[model samples]
Target chain A: MHKHLLLGVEAIGQGAIDGGMSGVYAYPGTPSTEITEYIQENELAIERQLHSKWSANEKTAYETALGMSYAGKRTMACMKHVGLNVAADAFINSAITGVNGGFVLTVADDPSMHSSQNEQDSRYYGQFAMIPVLEPSNQQEAYDMAREGFALSEETGVPVMLRITTRLAHSRAGVEYKPVLDENQLSMPQDPRQFVLLPAIARRRYKSLLDKQASFVKLSEASKYNQYTDAADKSMGIVCCGISYNYLMENYPDEACPYPVLKISQYPLPEKQLKKMEAECDSILVLEEGYPLVEEQLKGYFAGGTPIKGRLDGTLPRDGELNPDLVAKALGKETYVGIQVPSVVANRPPALCQGCGHQDAYEAMNEVLADYGKGRVFSDIGCYTLGALPPYETINSCVDMGASITMAKGAADAGLIPAVAVIGDSTFAHSGITGLLDAVNEKSNITVVISDNESVSMTGGQDSSAYGKIESICEGLGVDPAHIHVIVPLKKNHAELVKLFREELEYEGVSVIIPRRECIQRASRRKRNISRHANH
Target chain B: MKSNIILAGVGGQGILSIAAALGTAALENNLYLKQAETHGMSQRGGAVVSHMRISDKPIASDLIQMGTADLILSVEPMESLRYLPFLSAKGYLVTNTTPFVNIPNYPEYEKVMEEIHKLPRFIAIDADRIAKEAGNARASNMVMLGAASPFIDIDFAKLEDGIREVFARKGEQIVEINLKAIRAGRQFSEENK
Candidate 1:
């Protein structure tokens, strides 16, 4: 088996490949963007004929995966934890309609507002949909769970939710590989009543969903991923799920802890494993990230439920996330006094990279918008958004993907002069297109600068969805051809770019400025790829 | 046994590279390792941090609580100070003294250095200068790794091997430079000791 320093979202892609999946669909976002990007990068995945591409939005991505599933092909849909809120319609109904082919929804949750507006847990969504949710503790389990998750979905005829967190999605871990599984040549569901959500058929499918719960629970109990280690100390039994198990062991590393430890990596609350832990220990600690759902489930298992501890009992924090120090506190262990080395240095804030196209774009935009003062520039997520800092101070708002256009439209409608929206090419495709369409349809006066960097340089260098079609997208969206200006943002063209930028700002209708340049980092990656190909 | 480390630096400065090498070394030493990172917001040149916990058993969360990190491996002095709250009292801090002005802050270099000198348990080196002298300025992370080697349980040679494994896949030139850089760091730490 080979190993990889796979990121969390990349693990989902790896999982999909291992599970014999045919297609992977997603729109780029933090924590979830890497899934499709990885598949595109991996040679093995391409040779396997994996269908991995960025969709227009979460809804489009979800529907694409569903369509693939309907064709009797295994599929995986991925998005950020918050993006699920946008795709919830299809997500909820997919469970109600049941599944003909194996399918998995991989959502990467971000707690602490890390590149997100909020830290909402996606696990609750799975519970609401009444689908089995499986979370892996490490990259190995992440891969294994993905492989098994498909089978579980097939066995139950229900779509599965594999929820990952920022840590898992962004972190790299050593993942062992196995021989790729062969694809199943299965037939699509021909029974029209199975998918038709007419009330009569919907009621039958809902009953079938409930009827399958017992077997699903049984399968979860027998899942190889849910394990129990009889480090049984009747004094205290700890049941940890996903990455929490890693923390529990990290908190008490020196000793085996005179207690039983139940490691739950699968969902539906492995009752068999919980019962075994409860039988051995006096108090059980539910060490799962996000919610106390497992704790609540454990409470129902006991006659009065053997006193359970977790977020509810304040053993773990009610909100945010859990780490080693918190786990140590939960176990009542002496402080895990980490290394006591001292720093011989100071603190520094972040800045733009030298020779970055974003730097030039920000500078040109700032030069043109200097008269507008600060807080007038609306921006989306990308390297260019760093313009919000001093020196340039070009962008003011950065809410999420593709918010610049909508935000600029709103501000311009409110009479904010020279309303400017700056977004990257990848982000424009991710969610900015609709905002642009809204601006065009409403004839909102806004100037949008689409920084076409040829690649998504933020989460490593991945191909941008609008790699070669920025101009066409703008033209197709009814942007005035004369108002739409294209310029290669360089120091030499600074004056021209700034001039065009000003003209677009002065335009009454929606104007698009396409700042085209290859991201320097992506240029290096392409060089590496060419050299590799030459050597081969 | 449970030791949490917070390693911070600018993006593209090999922040993840250091964490990966450290994690591999710990894993090789039979320690259970969970190295978590944030790939969010740190678009290219933005600040980046990786949380690594090494223990003899499994771990739950990969996050390092505020003011609880045992070791802070900072490639840049300012980035190190940014993560000071994550460090435990008397926690070891190893960072390069070379000033890397990320934000357009006008604080004088000497003033920043003076402020860092006020902190507890600090070891400052001109890691960037040293790495540059060693012929690869990008090897500043290895210089910090040199300062951090003695405190952790993993062997220096193990870290050297991990570094080799990482860069080998990139190219022979990178492999050679990284190995030499790691050795230079190890030797520099030894000289100070």
Candidate 2:
């Protein structure tokens, strides 16, 4: 077998292509964006003409995957954990509606808030939707899970969720290729009313979903990824969930753990193994990467009789990620502490690129907003979110992807006249458009600044769905054509941008100010490519 | 045999290129490897570290445990100290003497150098100047990789092959230049040690 060193996300992309995925839908988000990106550039996927276009948003991406599944083809939708909130409606209902072909939803959770606002776990979504969830312990498992998850989804007539955290998603390991599977022939759902969720039909479908829970548990019990190793020491049974298993093993470098161990990569708590451990061991320790999902479940169902230990019992930190040293301490092993960093080392936080358009725009916005009180600008997620930091601390609030527009409108409605909303172009296309629509519908006295870099700059400059369509999108949404102003965001355009922002802030109705420039990083990359081409 | 390294630098410093070359070398040696990398906002200009592990046997954690890494290979001076906590007591530190002064609070050069001098085992080289001397300042990452290669357990020939494999797509000229850069680096470290 040939081995290729692949990142967790790249392995999933390869797996989906090899497993006969018809399409991969996604909006670029960290630790998850590379899946679709990989597929888009894969030779086999390109030859097969898989549907690998960037979706407008996660909601649209989820719906598109569902539609492809409805047409009897394997499909995968990918997004970051918070992006799931946008697709939660479609995700939850899909479980009830079931599937015709096969579907897998890959949600990458950023534990410790690496590049994200929150460290929310996506496995909870799997349980909430009453579907099978697979968490890979390593990169190879990430590949295998995505490859096999479709068949598992079809078996239960439900969508499968492949959950990964930042560590697993961004980590790289050698993965062996599996035999390629053929795509399902084009067909429709066997039952005409399968996806039609009327009240009466929905009740029966909901019952069907509830009925599948037992099988999911059974599948988890038999899952090859979830293994139980017995040891003579019954003093403590360790339950290492997902990548936590790696941390656990790292603690015992020389040999296996003395205590019996349960490594769970498949969900539903692996009932049979848990029961086996509960009966055999005196106590159980739950080691998981994200929130204490497994520990909390064991505590609740086992009724505290087992003396379970984890984040709740102070065995692990309640928040952030788990490392080998922390896992060693949990296993009652002496942790290795290294040399302390020298006092001369200073803290280096992530900042906007030196010559970024966001910097120029922020400088101008700060200049204009200085006249008004602080906290007037509400920003959305993107590279511009960095404006909340450093020399130009321009943005005030950053709640979600598209909260800036709505929050600004809400504040304007509360008589905080001339509130400003700063949003990135890709984000504006994702969910900011609707908020802009809401503002325009009511003619809210808010100024919406669409920071257009013509790419999703924060997530490494992926093609923005809102590219070349922003001004038209604003006009189409019924914003007055005269109020929509587009300006180049550059040092030379500083005075013009300041003047525009001031004028828009004073407007009585919704106004959009688009500061347009290609991302500096991307521009440089493009320049390098062009020069290389010319030289060649 | 195992080689664990904490590769550190400021974002956009081409550390990933060093990682790419190292991963290629590891694979060439048929060793099991796991490398955890930083992505997203950090690449815009933040402190970043990649935990690169290669072993003859199967590896467990993607992250190297604290005080277990055999080497802390950094492309920036201050970044070398950032992961000192992950370096084993007997491990060596190979770093570029050049400073990447993106942050406002960056420490004085003498202070940073004083900390480096305190390390019992280290090789400090001006990889940018070396790479420029070898004709391609962009190949500075390659030079640093060469400077650290003697510490890594992998074969030097395999590392050369790794660089060739990585830069082959760019053409023979690029490959030749990088090879020259790496050899210059290795020679410097050998003499300095």
* The best candidate in terms of lDDT: 2
TM-score of chain B of each: 0.89, 0.99
**lDDT for each candidate structure:** 0.79, 0.93
lDDT of 1 at A523: 89
TM-score of chain B taken alone, candidate 2: 0.99
Please name the candidate that would achieve the greatest DockQ relative to the true structure.
2
Candidate 2 per-residue lDDT over residues B1-193, each given as its tens digit: 9989999999999798999999999998889999999998888889999999999999999999999989999999999999898999899999999999988889999999899999999999999999999999999999999999899999999999999999988999999999999999999999996
The CAPRI class of candidate 2 is high
Interface RMSD of each: 4.8, 0.8
Give the worst 10-residue stretch by lDDT in candidate 1 chain A. Answer: A338-347
Candidate 1 falls in which docking quality class? acceptable
List model 2 lDDT by residue over A1-536, tens digit each. 77999999999999999888999999999979999999999999999999999999999999999999999999999999999999999999999999988899999999899899999988899999999999999989999999999999899899999999999888999999999898989999999999999999999999989987898899999999999999999989999999999998887778988999999999887899999999999899999989999998999878958899999989999999998988988888887767999888998889998888888999998888888979889999999999999889999999998999999999999989879999999999999998999999999999999999999888888899989999999999999999999998999999999899888888899999998999999999899999989877
